[model samples]
Target: MRLLQVVESAATGVGRHVMDLSGGLLERGDEVVLAYADWRMDRMFAEGLARLEPKGLKAIKLPFSREIGPEDLRSIRALRDLIRTHGPFDAVHGHSSKGGAVARVAARTVPRRLYTPHAYITMAPTIGVRKFRLYRALERYLARLGTGTVCVSHHEKAHAVGTLGIPAPTVHVVHNGVAGPARGDRESIRAELGVQEGDVAFGFVGRLWTQKNPLLAVDAFARLRAVHPEARLLMVGTGDLEDAIRARGVPGVELLGERNGPQTMHAFDAFVLPSDYEGFPYVTLEAMATGVPVISTETGAIGEAVRDGVDGFLVPPGDATALSGAMARLMADPALRARMGASARERAGSFTIDGMVEKIRTLYAG
Candidate 1:
């Protein structure tokens, strides 16, 4: 099938998702075109995309700010022109809100237009209620446009129908999948990060933006160290909240910004993601694939992936005390962590990129 994938932010999970998904399709001999705009690490991610496509990647000037505006209209116009010029795409898959808004509107001639919000705008707690209502209204408007939607997890699917007022038939749940690369040199990575041999490292990987709620994790780690001083927190990736994180000055927390996903996973004992909200995080899957038990909040599709008390523990979002307690349990019990780690790896095996591609292919066929 000839496919075009559109995304707004091309740096974090959505970028990784598009890159991996597009490459998988291309490898299967499907013609794939990826269009993106306003990514944090454009040069770095662009290089990765070029290597994946080699043929070329299309560019769309879009940003992840708000509902329809002059810039959004311009993006919609530009993408419409792109679709017209490119002509006759079999499927156009849009990732995240901005891409969904643009591609669905521009897909006048496309056979199948699919949207995955990654997480719907209403999922964001930081936004004002007025804005949330407006965005939901826009979503209701777009819902009538008749493009099928893919929610990243079952939890998110529920939100689409119940909260955002999207028709149930319009949404499908596709849990984010990840297959991590070979383990990195643990000794070397640990040495670089200043993690000692016996340290129970709680790691986090993703943007340090407000949505991620890094402070909760940091506060938890600080409390964790009082009980288990050998505990450490390894943070991978940086974002808008870097200065704020540094200002907090939490001890035993090493801010290792933006290392390789799979390789860096090797240096962690257990993974922690204390995000305020998530659609479904690839970082959690990546950590699980690396055989690291995850301690994440009970939000998004996390409960679907993490079997609480078996593979990992799920605390309430933004609850540092609960997060710290979970870490404390994992940190003090090596045997328990090992058992959970094994289970985590086993759970992650089903979420491979190959599996994701096959399922999406079936969706396209349907």
Candidate 2:
């Protein structure tokens, strides 16, 4: 099959998703062309890009800004031309809102044109009502141009159908998956984080934004510090609330800016995410893959991924007390953590990159 994957705002996990999906497709002997927006690409990504050249992966830069601007017109035209040049693509899959819109409109005649809104803007409570209404209306308006809207989680699919008013028949849920991580050097990773072997280290990864609620993580960790003075919390990733979180001077809290997810997982005894919302958190999944027990809010399809108390614990979103308790529960019981971590690794097997791509491949054929 000849496939074209369109990704807008491929700066974060969405970019990684495209890379994983495209790489999987290429390995399966599919001819794949990726046209992605330029947002954030680091040194590691540069090396990945170069490696992809020899693997028969075709990538094109078709930058799309976050806003609805004049550049969108050019992007649409470029997409249409690219489709014409790479004629008769078996499928054209668009990722995220902007990419979904442009791909559907530009290549409306494609036999199988699928769109995946990683997270719909309307799903965000922080987005004002008026803006949410406008985005919802836009999504509904664009549904006619695409063959299907792919959702990464059941929660996202429900929102698309119930809240966004997209036709139920038009939405397909394909949970995102990751390649299994190679075990990292535990001694070296812990040394880097200044977390000694005997001390329990709770870790959080993702931006310091309101949506992520890093402040909640800070407060929760602070609560645990009173009881478990040796408990260390490693907060990875920086964002808007970085300064505010730092100002609190939360005891035993260490702010380690963004690091490679798989590599740093070895430093954590347990993982915590008090995110207010999530489409489907790749961080939690990555943590689970590393055999780390998780304490996360029941957001998105997290409950589907994490078996509360079995693999780890799930608290209500924004409940610092509950989050802290869960963290402390893991810290207090090493045997429990060990049991949960092993269960987490077993549970994570079902969400592998091979499974996700195979599910998607079946969809393409159908």
Candidate 3:
């Protein structure tokens, strides 16, 4: 089957999804073309494309911004032309809002025009009521253009069908999957993060944006520090909240900006993500794949991944006190940490890239 995968902000999790899906399709002898925005491309994603290009992957840079703008008109036309040049794909899959909108409108000729809202904007708690209503309305209309909306999680699917008022039959759920952790020297990774063998290192990896709630992670880490002064927090990735996070001058917190997330997972004893909202982030699954327990907010389909009190603890979003308490629990009990980490790895086995890709491939055929 011939296919086209389109993405605008292909820098983080969404990029990983497209890369894994497209690469899997290619491996199965399917002709795949990836349409991406070079302006928003990161080194990691560019490198991903490089690996696949040699494997018969065709990539076209059709620049598009993250937000809605006048440039979108040009993006839609470019997408239409892409479909023409790569004539008659079996499917055209779009990732995220912008890419989803453009692909749905432009790929009207395609038999399967699928859109995956990695996370709908309306699902954000921080979004004001007016913005929420506006996005909901726009999404409801745009969703109809696609043959189906593939949500990355059940929670996201609920928002699409229930909140956005999209037809239930047209909205589908397909959980994101990981290829397990990258093998690396654990000792070397820990040493790079300044984490000693005795130190309990809590790691956070994601853009330091409002949705990720990096400040909440720092606040929780600070509280844990009062009890365990020797504990360290290793934060990877940079974003809008970088300055704000650094401004607090939180001690024992190493801001190691923008590193390979899976490779860096070896440095962590426990992973922490206090995101206020999510659509099942890959970093969380990568941490589990590395056999590290997680302490994340009960948002998105996180509960579906991390079994609270079994594999890890899930506290309410934005609760520093609860977050800190969970971190403290893991720090004090080495036996518990080991037990939970083992459970995490065992649970993570169910969500594999092979399984996810196979399901999506079936979706394309359906």
Candidate 4:
């Protein structure tokens, strides 16, 4: 089977998803092609494309942008042309807003088209209410034209059907998956980060953006420091808000921007995600697989990933006080953290990349 995966900017979650899916498909004897918009500002997509090439997956660059304009129309035409030439594909899976829109429209000329909004455009915190309503309307319209829609979490599926008014029958909730860590030397990773044996490390893995609520994390860490000064917060990934996050000057915070590969997971003793919203964050799953206890806001599909007080702790969204208390509680008790971490590792085994691939293959074959 031949699958064409379309996404805007090969960066962050959506980009990582495309690469993983492509690699998995190749391993299963299916042909996979990844098409992404040019990411000039950040070479993240380029780096991902380079990595994917070795696995026999081809990456195509298109002149597409997130913001809808004349260029987008031209890109849509280009997509249609590409489909005409290379498709009759078993499936065309689109990720993100712009890519979903383009792929759905282009696939009208073809047959099988599937769209997975990593996170819906209408649900974005940055978009205004009026614009969000418009995008929601557009998504509803597109749903009728597409073959199927995949939601990363049940919460996301609820929002799509309940809030966005998309039909329930067409949507499937396929949870995101992560590769388990290769059992890195924990003490070595900690020592390299300059953390002592007894020191507690709190880590967050995401862009330092408003949607991610990195400022809330800083504030929570500040509160946590009052009780446990030895607790360190290691923030991974860089974004526009990096300077502002640094400006807050919370004690015992280390902002190590964008460490790629397994080392990013190894650096953290425990993982915390204080995001305002998410579509099924891959980092949370990665943290869990790495045996790191996670404290996250009950946003998007996070609740599905974590059973509060079982695998990890979940607090209300945007609640800095609750976040701090959770972090502090985990930090103070090593036994509690260890137990949560063990449970997390066990739970993470269910959401493997192979499962995700097999599900997609079934969806396409059906």
Candidate of highest lDDT: 3
- Can you write out model 2's per-residue Cα lDDT over 31-132, one digit (the tens) per residue? 999887667565544565677869999988886777898999999999999999887798899888889899988987678889889888888878998898
- In candidate 2, stretches whose alpha carbon ends up further than 4 angstroms from where it belongs are 40-45
Query: Which one wins on TM-score?
Result: 2
TM-score of each candidate? 0.91, 0.96, 0.95, 0.94
Candidate 4, poorest ten consecutive residues by summed lDDT: 39-48
Report lDDT per candidate: 0.81, 0.86, 0.89, 0.84
lDDT at 38 for candidate 2?
A: 62
Q: Rank the candidates by lDDT, best first.
A: 3, 2, 4, 1
Candidate number with the higher lDDT (2 or 3): 3
Candidate that beats the other on TM-score, 1 or 4, i.e. the better one: 4
lDDT of 1: 0.81
Model 3 TM-score? 0.95
> Per-residue alpha-carbon lDDT of model 1 for 135-244, expressed as tens digits?
89988887666468887788888989999888998798777787654668878988887888888888888888887899899898888887777888888888888888
Q: How many clashing pairs in candidate 3?
A: 1
Tens digit per residue, CA lDDT, model 4, 1-366: 988888875677777777778888998988787777776324655776777788878777777876878888888888887777777688888888888888998778556788898878777767898898888889988898898898888888988999899889889988888888756787887887788877888998878888899889899999989778888998878889999988988888888876753556776768989999888888888889988889999988898989999988999999999999999889888899889999999999989888888887788876
lDDT of 3 by residue, 128-245 (tens): 9988988888887887788898988888888787778999998887888988888988999888777876998999988889989999999999988988987999999899999999
Query: What lDDT score goes with residue 78 in model 1?
Result: 78
Using TM-score as the measure, name the better of candidate 2 and candidate 3. Answer: 2
